[model samples]
Target: MEENNSFSIKNWNEDDRPREKLLLKGRTALSDTELIAILIGSGSRNESAVSLSQRILASVSNNLSELGRLSIPELMEFKGIGEAKAICIAAAMELGRRRRTGEALERKKITSSNSVFEYVQPIIGELPHEEFWILYLNNSNKIIKSAQLSKGGITGTVVDVRLAFKDALQLGAVGIILAHNHPSGTLKPSQADIQLTKKLKTAGDSLDIKVLDHLIITEKAYFSFADENML
Candidate 1:
């Protein structure tokens, strides 16, 4: 007796091809490999898109989760993935990451350092330079708005006290939480940090806006000026 079956992309049936399945059934109906095949676009001269995707995944340890973890540079290490595909993969992952984080933020009120850190950490965690952000708050302590105020180099960061107050006035904010990332990842506030905080606090005092806290963030950690009694 002879038993036979065909499983090549050519034999996947008209409805099962990635393009056809995507158009007819929607992308969710496809497996991880199928989704990756669509991203990969084409295959080697002898291989199909599905086969190339499978090979790429296998090179990353046979798990899509592992493949997802690879940075753009790391993903480009695989054969047949040039700059375009590498950027596509990285962009896709970043979009997914932002979506998940945004969902979490939507469910919570900004009430504590942890909450502010959770929101602002992602916005500034990977910056090569320093970024100063101001989180404006309403009467009940809910967030009114958040804005990046300034950016600077390793030693000298500048924040215009008048400009910061102007934004607070524009937001009609009753209070604010100031934050900046330490590219060096140190939570300790420098003397300059204290000087700037005092200036902003003084400006807020005059304008009847409370300066709630100044948060210093790093990729691995954060610091709160209020928590350390610096405010």
Candidate 2:
């Protein structure tokens, strides 16, 4: 999927170009493609970075949203995207996704299950399969760190609550949030989800660390067991 454009960035009037736009309007004003062009740094012999970015977006079904969801290996399918560029794109996309949550995450500390979803959704919501992850928090309820506890079938994935606690203890985490994705886009908490939360809660109780919430993320939304008083 290639569109031949006789006019490249060099042909465009410099004042209206993306680099100029960045300097003038600031980065927030640029679209995803425009930001991507800056990261690309250069295009092929015949094209400019902005042109390359346009072509890359076109190749990915003309969807910048889908491009935001691309895995590193999937991004490498582009002709000029080597390791560094691919990682740069991945990181930028991640940061952009996180920013979409608006200012709620910053105005106040996370207090409930929905708040936990706000943090985890950016990192794993777009995934097509399950990823069970844990957010370790300090006594203040601020997240200290996060780690993938397991990755497999959502309901049947092996989880060792003891091992999870061990990791949290090592980080001196005083609380934790359990998060996992539902590729089927259903937010309903499965029996397995409930069971896992119970295990984590019991373990946290023993360690004097609170289990903040257990979030079930779907493609478009999430469910919080704690919010529903289920946890």
Candidate 3:
């Protein structure tokens, strides 16, 4: 019952092995599969670690974002990948997600619509549903905090203007920017969107908090009310 066709990392040349190649040529020289192979350590007797890693990547169409969405149980469905390997992959992906969030949070000031888009895209743009967010800024226009005011389905979400202003007041923010994403990928603002912006601006005026802009974001592009002279 013994199978003859089997490949192992130990049987490969040192230059071809993932760990050795990484050490000799720098991490960038290793392909995605090689990098993942190093994380899981070894593959089944019938397959090399690189081959197994390739199959896993292939299952997700080689998309890292898609791969990041895979659950540990889903990864464990593959042969040679057990709880330990699955956990390792999940932990690595989570770290990457946190790193992206941290980078976005590190930006000091909001100078334009483009700056706001860059800051909020990683936080909500890629989401499959609608999310309304408010960026609270100090007198110098530096971001004090950003908070999600509401989350809804593909079509739309309800924003509580009261809660948004409450957070701004608590943070002592002198200015606020409103933003939300359309899951449909359309940048055109709805009549409701226009109405909401006007309402928020009026409320801000009463509180002495400036409503700087309202942005409608899709995955690839955005609409800025301020730039359009609608603010």
TM-score of each: 0.69, 0.67, 0.81
**Lowest summed-lDDT stretch of 10 residues in model 1?**
7-16
Best candidate, lDDT-wise?
3
- Put down candidate 1 lDDT per residue, 70-150, tens digits, no spaces: 778887787777788888877776786687569656844677888888888777765668999988888988787888888
lDDT-sorted candidate list, best first = 3, 1, 2
lDDT of model 1 at position 208? 99
Model 3 agreement with the true structure over 104-168: per-residue lDDT tens digits? 77876999999899888777776789999999999899999888999999889999999999999
Model 1 alpha-carbon drift over 4 Å, by segment? 1-79, 104-108, 154-156
lDDT of 2 at 176: 84
The true-versus-predicted C-alpha distance at residue 6 of model 2, in Å, is 19
Better model by lDDT, 1 or 2? 1
The 10-residue segment of model 3 with minimum total lDDT is 1-10
Identify the superior model by TM-score, candidate 2 or candidate 3: 3
Pick by lDDT: 2 or 3, better one: 3
Please, what are the lDDT tens digits per residue for candidate 2 over residues 90-109?
89877777786545446336
- Taken over the whole model, the C-alpha lDDT of each candidate is 0.80, 0.78, 0.88
Which pairs clash (backbone N, Cα, C closer than 3 Å) in model 3? none
Candidate 2, residue 15: lDDT = 27
Candidate number achieving the greatest TM-score relative to the actual structure: 3
